[model samples]
Target: MKISNQNKTLDLTYPQVMGILNVTPDSFSDGGRFNHIDAALKQARAMIRDGATIIDIGGESTRPGAAQVSEEQEIARVIPIIEAIRLESDVWISIDTSKPQVMKRAVAAGADLINDVRALTVDGALDVAAQAGVPVCIMHMQGQPQDMQDNPQYCDVIDEVADFLNERIAQCIKAGIKRENIVLDPGFGFGKTMAHNFRLINQFNRFLDFKLPVLAGLSRKSMFDHLLSLKVDERLASSLTGALLCAQQGAHILRVHDVKETADMLKIMNTVASATH
Candidate 1:
């Protein structure tokens, strides 16, 4: 499968690595690390050189209990970096945001995709995304980020997530967004308990029923921290394992922090699978 905008295209026939570039000062893992223009560009180029097909740029910290930033602040934080990246590279860029204005402005600046954790439920978000004319990734979150992790309950985690994504897909289509331009994420750590997270990963194939590309954003999530008693920096091994498992389950995109390691793992897996086939 291929996701394209006028400026760039990502071929997902093989697994694709989407490097995470959080331009915020409070993101869970890499906050304050690339909040500068020079650092951000350097990291973006490094990820591209390390085999990343897409660079996901986020201006807000969506970590649980995270506060929100205004549209103007978000635009200020990301637009310059987006512009700088475009001047030098043509790699696909994804704007990770939930605001309609951010979606529109980021696309104008050079973003090729919208990766909204709120699934465009925020007012005006659906309209802007439909009109942006780019690929959109709608993720499922049980509640607002502030209190989502307090008490995440579901009768059946996988079925509920699938139902929510399917409903959002219908809403996007009804809003005039083409089905082919849509992608789905089960949202591994967003408002999910440890059990819920594992169930989704183990049963991730259930999401293929939608017949759209699946994106797994499991890098440095709290599940590994809680399960393995490891800190964020120590979760690379766990993160790579989750990413490889997601690829094995047919996930098309892996939104990750360790771009080089994930890409190398995918390369080896593809090589063996090809040799067998």
Candidate 2:
């Protein structure tokens, strides 16, 4: 499978690494690290060199109870980086936002995909994404970021997530977004308990029922903290293991922080699988 925009196409026959570029000062992990244009560009270049095919840029911190930034502030934070990156490279750029104005500005600047955790539920978001003509990754979050993790309840985690994503897919199609331009994410830490997250990973392949690309974004999440009491910086091994599990289950995109390590792990896994075949 492949996802394309005006600038490039990403082949998903093999899993692809999407390097995270949080251009915010308060993201739970790696915040305040790349908010500067120079620093952000440097990280983007390094991720690309390290084998990332996509650079996901987020201006706002969506961590639980995170403070919100205005549309102007968000555009200011992300647009220059997008423009600067476009000047030097054609790597796929995904704008991680739910605001319609930000989505419009990011795409106009050079973003190739809209990776909204809100699934385009924000007013005007659906229309902006449909009009942008880029691939859209809709994630399932039980509630708004501020309180999503407060008391997330699900009768059945997998089924509920699947149902939510299915409904979003229908809404996107109804909004004129083509079926092929959609991707699905189970949303690892968005509002899930540790058990809910583990269950999703174990049954990750269930999302393939739609036959669309699935994106796994469990890199350095709090789930590791819950499972092994590991700090964010100390979760590399756990993160890589989660990534491999998702990849093995047919995830098309691995959204992560450790680009080089994840890329190397996937290379090794692919090499071994090919040898057996």
lDDT agreement with native, every candidate: 0.94, 0.96
Clashing pairs in 1: none
* Model 1 quality (TM-score): 0.98
Model 1, 1-277: lDDT tens per residue? 7777766677888989999999999999999999999999999999999999899999999999999999999999999999999899889999999999999999999999999999999999999998998999999999988989998999999999999999999999999888988989999999999999999989988888888899999999999988999999999999999998889999999999999999999999999889965
Alpha-carbon RMSD to native, per candidate: 0.9, 0.8
Which residue ranges in model 1 land beyond 4 Å of their true spot?
none
Report the CA-based lDDT of candidate 1 relative to the real structure.
0.94
C-alpha TM-scores of all predictions: 0.98, 0.99
* lDDT digits (tens) for residues 1-277 of candidate 2: 9888766788999999999999999999999999999999999999999999999999999999999999999999999999999999999999999999999999999999999999999999999999999999999998888999997899999999999999999999999998988999999989999999999999999999999999999999999999999999999999999999999999999999999999999999999989965
Question: How many collisions between residues are there in candidate 2?
Answer: 0
